[model samples]
Target chain A: MKGWIYQLKSVRKDKFCIMSFFLPVLVAILLNFAGSIDLSSLGELQFVLTAGDLTSETTEWLARYGTVMICQTEEELISEINDPSTNLIGIEKDGKGIKTILSGDEWAILQQAAGTLPLLYEQRESSAQVGVQILSRPDILAGYQHIFAAMTLVVAMFMGCTFNAMNIISEKEEGVVFINEILPMSPKEYLIQKIGIGFVFGCLSALITAAICFRLPFARAAVMLALLVLSAFVSSLIGLFIGRFSNGLMIGVVYIKLVMIVFMAVPMISYLAGVENRILTFLSYLIPSSATLEGIMDLANGGTAMAGKDTVILAVHGIVWFLLYLLLAGRGKKQA
Target chain B: MWNHNKGNRDPARTNHRLTGKSCKTRSIWKSLRSLLQKDFRMMRSGKFFAVALGSLLLYTLFIHFAYVRFMDMEIYQVYLYDPAGTQRNVSPLVHPVASLEEMDRILHKDANSVGIHVTDGKPEVSLYTASKKLDRHRSDYALSLLHPGGKYTPETVGGNNLEQKNRRDITCELLFIEIVAVGFLGIASVLFKEKQMGVMRVHAILPLPKSLFLFSKIFLFLATDLVFAILLVLCNVGLSGTGKILPGLLIQTTILSLVMALTVFGCAMILKDFRQFSLAYLVIALFVTAPVFLSANTSIKMTWIRFHPFYHIYMGLKHAFFGIPVANPLYYLCAAGAVVLLFGIVKTAFCREMEKEG
Candidate 1:
């Protein structure tokens, strides 16, 4: 444990390592600030939309200023146009041109009236016509949040893994492994220390993400932290295992980069494509970042704890990957 | 004496014959088997299967106890206003307020309501317009309210209601998220393990085709992901309902699985270590994922996001869930192109990885 602490401390002392811990947090925070801008815009759009419904003081004011035309028929509508107190009350008949013949400013007045209120006019043809497309606001917001959550998970996981993955390869290339190798520890201990360091780094990054990108209550924050720890551990194991297998920085780079694209990016693609199925959900537990993302989504949705299933899924996933990492490390001994 | 016997047999033209391509194919299989065997052995100690099983159990429990329960709360709080008694026949479920100010307040507080205001004795509805797609729905609702029980009822296609829609929608998202993010890591983590042991490089000099090394892992991940998908859908969305859509969903999942695996394989080869990879992952999660999620799931619209590749993927998944066929040939073409492109990149990266100095 002392040896582990010493190694972690030494890693922190390195400027690059220090930057690795903070950069994602900074980015997440920046993005959070940016996301908040959308919130304000959403608020503005909401206000504008709802504003149109409220008693249009202007309509009442217009009643005193302009000629009011209240007519049920086209001829009456035409006659009332000159009389000023005109409002139209008539059904637009199907397959016919305004049915009743009305001359003068009736057409112009009706056209002008149609502009203010939600008006429907009949276009006469053999087939009936009803406007056929509609969408709800909440559904729109839900879609936005869905996509946002996916993107957040992707970016967060990518940053989380890349920084951790690079450290392993870069250090190996720099012969930094020698220092740890020289210490009085087995390869297992060494691997464990590195994994621990990555976990801590991930925790810090997740905190940064939670703090800057989202604001949650303490209960939610704790749940998020727990998820971050597991996610980071799994990611670290992947990085360390890849670093161990790789011959140099080049191989290491390829390995980690591909992992991010496949594991992290594709899930978001699934989301973009609007797939909803139990199979995808089940698969979600298999991916380390998926849990992190789910957790983040729960937090984003104002939930304090991750849905019980997501937490268990992520935890199990992390443990599984960690063990696989160990086995791989053991195999590393034969080649080394 | 042995050489004479063999020469004599050959001179006699024994029935034992072989084609070069068949020989190549057999050797390729042998190589694949060996590679898969080695990976399986390595992954065993790593408890890969155990983890999967545990994840299955855990996710099952959580879904039953947590996720399903949590999502069972309420629908969008709908608020309506018509002062002239125009909607006397409107459903009582629709909350009718006396004034427009009340509607504004409710919408403001709700932030997610479809606001309907009858002004100048004509009903005009307003909602936070998020997408061009949603604009159509708003218009339909506004027009529908004008005549209660009108003949313009939208034809029922699939049996999914609003809640079921949410269920399937979220399920698909979680699944996609899992395969894309988690499966990618699974392949990488396993490969990274092998790579660290210098076994990947060893495969290069083997008598078998090198592609099998990548294929075996992809196959394993694809299978695992597919299985997980099956269970998740069956368990959450119900067996009977998901049954009809399973085959199509599986095909879509497979396509996604292969594409993501190849892409990650290429990326893992090109990047440095977990740290650097994590940074890249972060960038991807933030940028690529952010725009896709924002555009797909939220009210925030980026007109440019329609051009994004994942946007189509997300919409495709959504369509797939609702039993909608991804009828666009162009979509399939683009997805195939992406997969092929990623595969080529992975092959190139694999060669480069093989050439790297120890």
Candidate 2:
């Protein structure tokens, strides 16, 4: 109870810590705004650049594709092509044919469109023979919005790891650990209190983030909350391990960087890319953050949020890291 | 008292005073050198350089083995179900599906894939839609495959193929992230260590200017980042064209490194502990940098991104990677002015920190 009170008092004192609690809400709102943008109007044949002399018919033919901006010189065309902001493709008259100038990061479709312009212009009359009808199906995971939300939630949970790690490290730096040595609480109890506080904060951050980002049914929200609690349990254990081993804040930062990359970045990338590789799948399952993210994503996608593979994985991870922390704490007690 | 007065009037006393001034200058140089060495040692002990090397290796490997290969995968796979065999001249890239059920299964598995169902002679495209614009592109690409013989033979201007472009683009982005995120944290962690150790307070009583303390750390980080930029570019961008881009790349890197290092230095001085600094870092990483990336890389347009300082720095780095000189005088002027301003703020913060009671 004393430990919890101490932790709460420290959190209350730190204004930045309080601000971090609201970060996920801010990010979720930004993502919502981003999702609301009308993306259909973009990349619909707007600007194509050309230089040098072309007959009136050629110019008229080019006009069918998009608004053709004619540059007086090849230098000017090249200049426009080099501009990073402009999505212009430059065409210059070459002997009997034309050459395309690209900024090189143009979309594959845009590149193909530019490449096939001459042929498309040549067969403009007969190009309508084969008809195209687009049958649009409803996407299960709608757009990047859900994915972004899931990422935000995962980030929010992981912030617990940072908090716990910094908490212990700062205690050591401030000579609080020495004081704790003379206190009545056992090292094991102290560890529990630290992890418990982190877990509580983690759940709070996750809950706030989910509240802003999603409107799930009660059962689903309960399952998500359970999964988040498990995630926080594992994250706190990892933080305890980092704080125990690292000598200073600098080393702790490095460890956190590595942890975030392995646990957060790799899984997020795999999820976004829809990678089907078995090794990657296995790796993601093994990592606690990845499994938790997968569970949250499943829930967000309207999957039945019950005891599933991700739940088992996260539970197992919590057990494993907990055992490891106990063993390290025991070893430190023996050494002392 | 008479001997003291005689000595003060002596020529040797004047020579002694000149030597004393030179000794003071030499002592400042010595102090700066020792501070740099101490920081370097601390960084070494903290494994900062090791982590940097590891990151370099990881990034290089990902670029060569993963990112390039992943990018090389077809953007949208196109499947065609043509029972009448009307489209004889379809592109080989499009897979021929046996039945509508098979097309449905494939499309279900690969949501990004587009299916063209040809009945009689007309082709109808079906797919899980991404965006209206992207869906249109996928359908058009599917239709374009019908006339595979109609080739596009436009000459590429810069002559850099797709692979080269991807390499440069990804390298530039990773390097920027490394400097902005990792480098910023790296300086903070180091400074926080000094603060934790009471060394900063000791420096307050020393006969050295506090700004040299800031300068030494900044110089060390700047050099390290510049070296990292060189290696990352050389390894990923390759040797063929590195020469042309290195100068501009290094200049932009120096500006970014100094700005990040100094900013973090100031923050670390002001913030009480690593926990608070971590919160600040989180804010900067998510709020400050994320928007810059989204606006620059994606179609998501922000009308006010132009006002964001990091946006220009990011664009400047990108332009340098593509060998485009930022000809705007205002950019360089602004960057220099910002660096000077940050330096002033950091110095003031350092002074305040030094004055604070432990």
Candidate 3:
């Protein structure tokens, strides 16, 4: 109880720690604003450069694709095409035929657009009588807003791990470890208090983030909250393990970065890139944070089937890491 | 006071004053050298270089083994279900599906793919709904593949092939992240260690100027980052044509390294402990760097990203990687001015920290 009270006092006094607790809320608001900006038009946007005068008919036809820029000489057109920063498809007319210039780094879709324009112009009509039908998949993940929001929430929850590690290192630096050795409390109890505080803060921060960013029904919200708690427990144990071994801030940070890259970045990137590699998928599921991310994303997309597996993985990780931390703590006590 | 008569004419007194000035200069140089050595030893003990080397190896392996291979995939896959076999000139890239059920299963698995169902010599395109514009592009791409021979082939202009472009692009981004994130935290960790050890306070009573302490660290990290940039280019970008880009790349790395190192130096000096600095680091890394990446790399446009300083720096580095020098004189001026301003702030903070009671 004293330990918890002391931690509460420390966190209350530390303005930065308090700010960190609210950072997710702040980031969620920012993401909300960003989400309003429409990026759909980017797919259709293109820059077309032409040398000399184009027939009015040609200009009108080119305008169907995107913006058309006319340059006085072939030199100007080539210059624009040479600028790797801009993706411009250049057209130059010669006596024999027309030449099309490309920067080579254009997207495959844009390249297809470039190729189809001239052909479609020559045909003067759509060659393939294609009727386009849009199939709606209700099970697909939500827009970038929710994905980014969930990512931010997950990253914010892991802040508990960082804070816990820093807390232990700071205590060691301030000679609190030696002072605690002579106190009545056992090291196991002390370590548990630290990890417990971290777990509690992680849940609180995650709740704030989820509440501000997402509006879900009670059951989904409750499931998400439960998953985040499990994630927090596993992360706190990892933090406890890291803090027990690492002597300095740099090493502690290095360990945290490696953990985050594996547990957070891999799953997020795979999800974003739509990677279907089985080995990568298996590896992602094995990591507790990655599993939690998958669960959170599933819940955000209105699916609950995957949460069961994620909960099992996180619970297993929590137990294994906690036991390892206890073993390390016991050895340290014996050495002292 | 009458002893001034001997001092005015005595060579010994004059020599003593001269020697005193020279001794002070020598001691300052000696102190700076020792400080540099100590920092180097501390970094070595902290395994910073080992970590950096490990990162370099990992990045190299990833670029070669994974990233390049993964990028070879097409933007969108096209599947065709043509029972009538009416499309004689279909692109070889399109996959032929046996039945409508097969197409549905594939579409469910690969949501981004477009399916063309041809019935009675007419093509019908179906896809999972993305954006309206992207959907149009995907459908257009799918239809264009039907008459592959009619597609116009363009003359190639200047630019690296897709493989080289991906390599350099990823290398630049990783290097930027390494400097901005890891290097920033590294300097803070070293400084915080010194602060905890009461070494900064000890420097106050020493005869050397406090600024050397900051300079040694800043220069050490700058040199380390520059070397890392060089090796990263050589390893990932390969030996071919690295010489041309090294100068501009190193210059950009120097500017970024100095700015990050000095900013963190100032923050670490002012902040009371590692926990506060960690929070500060998080804020800077997330809020400051995230937008620069999103605006530069993605289609997400921010009207105000031009005002962001790191945007220009990041673009400059990217251009350097692509063999385009930043011709804007204003950029260099601003970077230099920022560096100078940060140096002043850090110096003041270091002095204030030195004056604090332990």
Best prediction by lDDT:
3
* Residues B1-358 of candidate 3: C-alpha lDDT, one tens digit per residue: 6788766777987899999999988988888889989989988876778888888999999999988877644467999999989988888889999999999999988898999999988889999986655666677767777877654677787767777878988899899988998777777787888888888888888777778888898989998899899999999998875888988998899999999998888888788887788878888998677888877776566888899999899989988898889998999999999999999999988887777743
- Clashing pairs for model 2 are none
Scanning candidate 3 chain B in windows of ten residues, the lowest lDDT window is: B130-139
Better of 1 and 3 by TM-score: 3
Interface RMSD of the candidates, in order: 19.0, 4.1, 3.3
> On DockQ, who's better, 2 or 3?
3
Q: Supply the DockQ value of model 3.
A: 0.47
What candidate 2 gets wrong by more than 4 Å, as runs, is A33-47, A50-76, A83-88, A91-100, A103-113, A117-133, A139-141, A178-188, A305-307, A327-336, B1-24, B73-75, B355-358
Name the candidate, 1 or 3, with the larger DockQ value.
Answer: 3
Give the per-residue lDDT digits (tens) of candidate 3, residues A1-336. Answer: 988998899888988777877787788877776446545544444555554456676666555555567777777787677654566778655343345678787666556566655554454357334678899765233454567778878877887887788788778867897888898998778877898778888888888888877788988887888888988888777777677777867878888888877876776876777657898788767677778878888787878888777778888888888887778778877896
Considering the two chains of model 1, state its CAPRI-style docking category. Answer: incorrect
Where is model 2 chain A poorest over a 10-residue stretch in terms of lDDT?
A: A38-47
lDDT of 1 by residue, A165-197 (tens): 666676776787777666678877776677776
Q: Candidate 3: how close is chain B to the reference, as a TM-score?
A: 0.89
Candidate 1 regions with alpha-carbon error over 4 angstroms: A1-19, A25-336, B1-24, B58-158
* Backbone atom clashes (below 3 Å) for every candidate: 110, 0, 0
